[model samples]
Target chain A: MITCDMAVSIDGYVAGPNQRADAPFGDGVGDSLHQWMFEAAEENAAEIAAITDAGAFVMGRNMFGPGRGEWDLDWTGWWGPEPPYHAPVFVLTHHERSPVQMEGGTTFHFVTGGIEEAVTRARAAAGERDVSIAGGAATVNQALAAGLVDELRLHVAPVLLGQGERLFDGVGRTELTPAGVRQTALVTHLRYTLSRTAG
Target chain B: MITCDMAVSIDGYVAGPNQRADAPFGDGVGDSLHQWMFEAAEENAAEIAAITDAGAFVMGRNMFGPGRGEWDLDWTGWWGPEPPYHAPVFVLTHHERSPVQMEGGTTFHFVTGGIEEAVTRARAAAGERDVSIAGGAATVNQALAAGLVDELRLHVAPVLLGQGERLFDGVGRTELTPAGVRQTALVTHLRYTLSRTAG
Candidate 1:
């Protein structure tokens, strides 16, 4: 299944303002958005495991690093040398770069073609396993607009960012059926099955 | 206690495009948003009853009618001589008009001052009973921004409008705890208790 998982604020913002080199989430706002992942690790163990369990992952350039234009060779990613995805990870970007092989079988393949190309490559790499769309909002919106996603899981945080990058800013209209719903004090896990035939 | 209730699309839009003289919800979009009220009345009886059971109600001018600038003296409201609001209903408007008394003890008191004034008048008329903030999106956002609403009940429709009047457009940051949640095939009823102390 082509699944996309994201943690969003009540207002549908995936990340807060001023996304830069030092402050990725801006004003330490992103930290509060993912408190459910760490603070209630035991309770959300299944969800945490579901996020990185895919055989291959596709993410936008912004998710890889804070740099723009030229590729910053020094900055690998937010995750250390080993990273989390123990499989092939495709990074969608305008600028092309050679694949970076990290420790623990994770290789970052920069795809300049577009979202479709990245997903195609991820699917090829994934084989029988699912191609997970690890997002930063824009990439997910692109995927949804293209009707590439099969399942969409949203970790809805109770907090509101007020202003930032919204998940469904330019997504237009997409049909989804509520497959399942689970709630915690910090976040509500809503699972949606995307209608391939409907828009 | 003060309460705010609204039926919104999955994308948070309360109303759709091209709101005109004939189509109040903009091109028959409002019908799908409130299918639970009509189609499944028996199941949602409590929710339907809760909406108009208030002693007094407050609404924006937009909810009263589609007229802008000056009030069409003849235009009482979309509702006939006898409106759903059986009690005193305060309408927030810039163009002040004399209170229009309707059948079944319903009176439309046009409050020119602001949301606070409308609430105040509604509160006075309500006596010990709760005051309801009947919405058209803007009014509810204003009430939420001003920290006037004590409880928020959202009738979340499964459909997606894509673009329209959003409920949390410019309400800034507000804290709310999920008080109650109920779901039907048509809609999901989410009740939130506004934390006036937190923002």
Candidate 2:
């Protein structure tokens, strides 16, 4: 299955504007968006575990690093030497680069084609398990528009970021069937499966 | 206390686009946005009771009728002879009109001043009970932007309305402290208290 787990504000922003090397998620958002994953880890244990349980991961170039246009060989990723994904990770970028092997069996492969190419490569690497779309808004929106995602998991925060990257803005009309819902003081975790039937 | 109970789609739309006299919530939305209130009445008994528990209600002119500019004296409301609001309802409008008393002790009073004036009148009519901001997205957004709301109860359905009357788009930055959360198969109920801190 192709799945995506994303965190969004009450105003529908995934990350606030003016993202930089210092502030990855952008200016106002910062760490508050994912604070539930850290501060309320115990309450969100199941969701946290499910986040990285996929076999292969696919992410956009912006999610991979802060640089643009050319490749930044020095910059590995937001995560440290040993990345969270212990499997292969396909990054969608315009520039192509050689695969970089990390400490804990994690390999970063650059795909120059597009979202579809990246997902295809990730699915091949996934083998038996599912492929996760590790997003930065643009990539997830593209995947949803192309009908690549089967399941969607949303962690909705209570704050409203006025100006930022929004989710589900340009993906067109889509139908979702509720799979499950869990809530805590910090965030509300909602899971849904994309409906294939057209009305 | 000034409170609001709003039903929104997963994409943050309170109601779909192209609202009319026949299709109240717009084209595709129809009664789907409020299907939970009727279908899951048993599971959401507490929330259902809390919704109409308010003594007085405030709403936008659009929620009152489909006509614009001049007063539609012939039309009363979408509801039948006896409206749901048993007390007084202050409707914000640009035109002036006399109060229309309905069955079951409900009275629709037109307020030409604005949202603040309407809210003030509703509060006065409420007496000891809480005032509710009965909405159609525009009014709720106005109340939230003006910081007139004390609590917000959101019933989020698992559907995506691509275009419509969106909530919190131009409300600027706001902070909400999560008070409670409840979930059913049809909808997820989230309650939040507006935070007063500047930071």
Candidate 3:
């Protein structure tokens, strides 16, 4: 099963505006969205573990790094030499670059083909385990519009970032069924199953 | 105290598009947002009661009816003779109309002076009881932008209305702290307190 986990503000922003190399998730966003994951780590351990438990991960180029356009070969992502994924990670981008092997088992493979191609490659690498779509609004929106996602896990923080990258903006009219819900003081974890599947 | 209760879809849309006299909440949103309130009345009894517990209510013109421009003197709102709100109700509109008195002490008072004026009138009528901002997005956004709300009670339904009237749109950058949370099978009740107050 394909699943995605996202941290969003109450106003539907995944990340605030003015995202630069200094502020990865954007200017005002900071780590506010993921405060529950860190501040209440013990309580949210299962959800935290689930985020990186997938065999392979697919992510957007912007999520991989803040650099746009041409490949910045020097920048090896925000994560250190040993990234958290510890699995094959497919990054969606327009420009192609050689796979960057990291410590542990994580390997960053750039996919120039598109979201479909990246997911396809990630699925192949995933084998028996699930292929997780690691996002930055754009990639998730694309996957959602394509009906590639089976489950959507949203961690809605209680703050509002008036303007930023919004979710479901151009995904068209979609329907979801509630699968699960859990809440903490800082965030509400809402899980949804897509009513329509990729045919 | 001022409080607002809104039924929002998972995607943040308060109501869907093509809102007509027949479809008050627009197409594809026919009572889905309030399904939990009806289907699980016993479970959500407290929330249901809290919604109409306010002494006075303020709402936007669109939420009152589908008519535009001049007031339809014949129309008396969606509810019949005796509405659920058995108190003074303030309707925000550009076109002015005389107060319409109904059964059960419910009165529809039109306010052409804008959201502040409507809310001010509702607050006055409320006396000691909390004044409720009965919404249809635009008015809610206006109130939120103005920081007139003291508390916000959001009933997030587990469905996605791809397109429609959305909440928190153009409200500028705002912040909310989580105050309460409750979840049932069909909906999640999230209550938040605004960090910024109306001065």
Candidate 4:
């Protein structure tokens, strides 16, 4: 299943001004909000640790890095020498960058035809495992609207920013089934199983 | 529909350490999230403003804010002046906090029991709209495993933190259907319609 792993402030914000691109995230105020999962050095830590057949990830150019901001040009690579999301990561970008090959089995492919083609390639590469619509809100939104995602997980943090990048908006309404919930000292992890109620 | 509204660094980190108790919410890295949503300021912005009659909101104590960290105190009044989530918010806490009323229509209900109780109450309150499970990670994980959510919305930002909280961990096997996706200037909003697949 496709799971969207993200964080938000208790006040319902996603990130702060693009100016402080270095701040942990948009919440400008929170520190513990998105730290739980990324701290896990293990391969399973970055993801749910569930093994699937095999597929690639479809992502927006920004999801991988800032596509249009001033920082867009300076960013070398967000994930370090080896990022954990080790799969074929398809990035939707306008600027052309050579494919990036990582250590743990991740390759960044830049695609320009929006998300449909990205999913097609991801699924084909996945063979049977299932593709991941890796994000940047635009990418996930693209995947969802195209009816390409399968599951989504949100690790919501407790904090109120009063404002920031919101995860909801633009995308049409869709229904989901709550599969499970896990609480830790810092954040609450919500896992959702998606179902289509109508066309 | 459930939107996992959150923001993280380009490296996938949500916040910093300590989760400082004395610090104001929007004071640090976690505050970067929520820029887009607040700007939208839909009528329901602070009031669950959807006007769609979304029922109870599932929340973990940390998500509720206030008495987070190792102490696990029964601190309810997390939102300060007027808490955001106006619906019946279920706070998963080991300690008990009396339901407190806020300026808007928001009320905080503490739940020592698991997430099921929170979901049940939220569902009941949602008369027609739907139950929105606000997070903290643990709470969401429980809900996903139980299969109660109907939709998943993920807003992916442009930053990536090399470390921080993660949305999914040990989420086992779950399946879903992609409802739709939307591309925006800030975040990519992806909505996944849910379905039942496995435990």
Candidate with maximal DockQ: 2
Global CA lDDT of candidate 2, please? 0.88
Error of 3 at B141 (Å): 0.9
Better of 1 and 2 by lDDT: 2
Q: Over 4 Å off in model 4, which ranges?
A: A19-21, A27-30, A38-54, A67-76, A196-199, B1-199
The segments of candidate 3 whose C-alpha lies over 4 angstroms from its true place after superposition are: none
Q: Which regions of candidate 1 deviate over 4 angstroms?
A: A28-30, A197-199, B27-30, B197-199
Candidate 3 chain B minimal-lDDT segment of 10 residues = B190-199
lDDT of 1 by residue, A1-199 (tens): 8999999876777887889878877653756678899899888889989999998999999989997798987778899999999999999988878999999989999999999899999999999999999998889888888888889888877766677888876777655666776777777777778876422
Winner of 2 and 4 under DockQ:
2
lDDT of 2 by residue, B111-170 (tens): 998888888889899999999999968998889888899999999887888889898867
Error of 1 at A36 (Å): 1.7
| A-chain TM-score of every model | 0.96, 0.96, 0.97, 0.79
Better of 1 and 4 by TM-score: 1
Error of 4 at B36 (Å): 30
- In candidate 3, what are the lDDT values of residues B1-199, reduced to their tens digit? 8899999988899988989998898888888899998899999989889999999999999989888899889999999989999999999988989999999989999999998888888988999999999898999999999999989999989877788999998888777877888888778888898854672
Clashing pairs in 2: none
Deviation (Å) of B47 in candidate 3: 2.0
What docking grade does candidate 3 earn? medium
Q: Interface RMSD for candidate number 1?
A: 1.9
Which parts of model 2 have CA positions greater than 4 angstroms off?
A196-199, B196-199
